[model samples]
Target: MKLLKLTLAVALICLVSCAEKGSRDTAEKETAVTEAPAEKAFKYWTWITADPERTDDSYQEEFAKYKDNGLDAVLINTNTDPELLGRLTPLARKAGLEVHAWLMAMNRPGDSVALQHPDWYAVSREGKSCFDHRPYVDYYQWLCPTRKASRNHVLGLVEGLAKVEGVASVHLDYIRFSDIFLPIGLLPKYDLEQEEELPEFDFCYCDVCVAEFEKIHHKNPREMENPALDIEWKQFRLNKIRAVVNDAYEIAHKHGKILTAAVFPYPEMADHMVRQRWDKWDIDVVLPMIYHNFYNEEIDWIGFATKQGVQDLKYKDTELHTGVYVPEMSPSEIKEAVQLAKENGAKGVSFFDGPALTDDMLQAIKETKEGR
Candidate 1:
């Protein structure tokens, strides 16, 4: 009986000790999981205009500076020159930066091939072709997205860039109609007021666009007295832009690349101001140029705009990266802008231009990236 009791006691002790050990192991695993760091998904990007005249060594140095300061990607405007993009791609990749071929999609300022086709240019509501009259800026030589030739020309450029080795995306800039309403702060610079959609600024009333709209809606947009009030007319233009973007997306994917665009602030604002409804388009990423100073808005407006875009894209796979204008911002404001963008659910923040980022601004970005 004593031996049996001793055996039972030993078994009880072993069972309790094993249970305690199992509990301790579970606690250790739980602690480990609790202490494990979350993976960082936020990215940093910058827009840069590439100069063919610059030496490779110079570009290498520039790219290295951007990378060292926490930039992960660069949208390089090579003036739609795929060869230039191809030349710069490897160099940027060598410096640990992802390369994006940035093209001025609809606004082809001095496109040699496009300049040969005047009919492809967008016509204003006042019957002035952007081919010559050019809108508020001389560079606003936007093409009519509804025109097959012009759109194909733009898609061809996208395909050319997509073919470049190691390019992350074919970045389309100026993908919308020429702004019907200029930013409020910029209105003074242009010496004008935009209380209404001025005929001079309203666009794509070209014969092709008119005919296309008439065919679809059985009414001519040009015949409408107040075309701005015509919902179908506005929707037609918006759909035209969306079509171009969707086609570009397909072209990019065909070459195993993604399509990205530098768009206006948000869907509703974009549609109202520029006939662009980016949220409805098929794209991989949309970096909205939420430059608050352009609208005479406060810094916190960046967060507001970022959150708006993020909410609009909640169901989309398209990522939103808030694009900030660094030229007018101080170092402290830069940090605040980055934090606001993060807090508002931006996947990343991109500076307007790489050259505009001062050392202090870069340091601010670096520190913000390091969580310092």
Candidate 2:
């Protein structure tokens, strides 16, 4: 909404009814010199992930083959190794591809910060001492957003990458709370009652959060007593995390780079799972992970979810890049999914991971440039 307001002000600046292309060329050149990769504005995209510290011989060979297929970009998940980035930057450029640095957010690697600092994990509402993984669905722990050290580390990594040349954007993943949910039926083994009351569907009543809540709202959320019943506080918590990522956008843009994030399929999924307020942020781009096999068996589900994301979050002139699950679907399906996204106002689609990619899928990707 705020963006729409700003857009209206800019619209009034243009009074021309006819083109003055020669005069505008000088201004376009200045903008290009200032805005590097983000200003280029990719049209269609896909990706490939390299193995961790493994030799890149095969990776390079595949990329060489990829050069002819017309991939707009690749998402590389390199934890550190600035030297690897140096090599990768040129390799990707040689193949005529844009690069997005895919870095882990809250889901810290075992040997990474989370293992050394257990304080980073968010505690659940039941007073259980554990990480914020889906209440009963998963086994992993996610970092608490309120903690400055962990949050700083995540942002620092992005800031480091923003300095990399030819890197269009820093693609962030796991940008919010751990996946949290309650399973369908209570297990009889745990002696749980069939009609027993559960707190809220997912997430967090950690001591730190409770203390912070009391300080801010002067009441406990559990007493205000629920997410469905007390939706306001839930949104407040979402805003707290949103502020961190939104702040990261400021850091990126200051360096003339774009801040992009991969979020869940829908707003409900985002709010229920991690309290991510995607609708509010001014992120340069949003790649909603449209992993639909987890939703239903419908073949058309990917396109449907992509549209929902574009409709719900994207603003006019804002880019939407659909995250296609390359390993799970057929080649033709991948191609069709990309096409569906384009038709429904998406700027591009990105493959989730790159190494599992097949040549047939690359062939299908070439068809996306048909009308271009």
Q: Which portions of model 2 miss their true places by more than 4 Å?
A: 1-42, 129-139, 182-201, 222-228, 314-317
TM-score for each of the candidates: 0.91, 0.78
What digit string (tens of lDDT, one per residue) describes model 2 on residues 294-366?
Answer: 5544557667777777787545444678887778788888777877787776777777666666888777877
List candidate 1 stretches off by more than 4 Å: 1-40
Clashing residue pairs found in predicted model 1: none
Q: Candidates' lDDT values, in order? A: 0.94, 0.68
Worst 10 residues of 1 by lDDT: 219-228
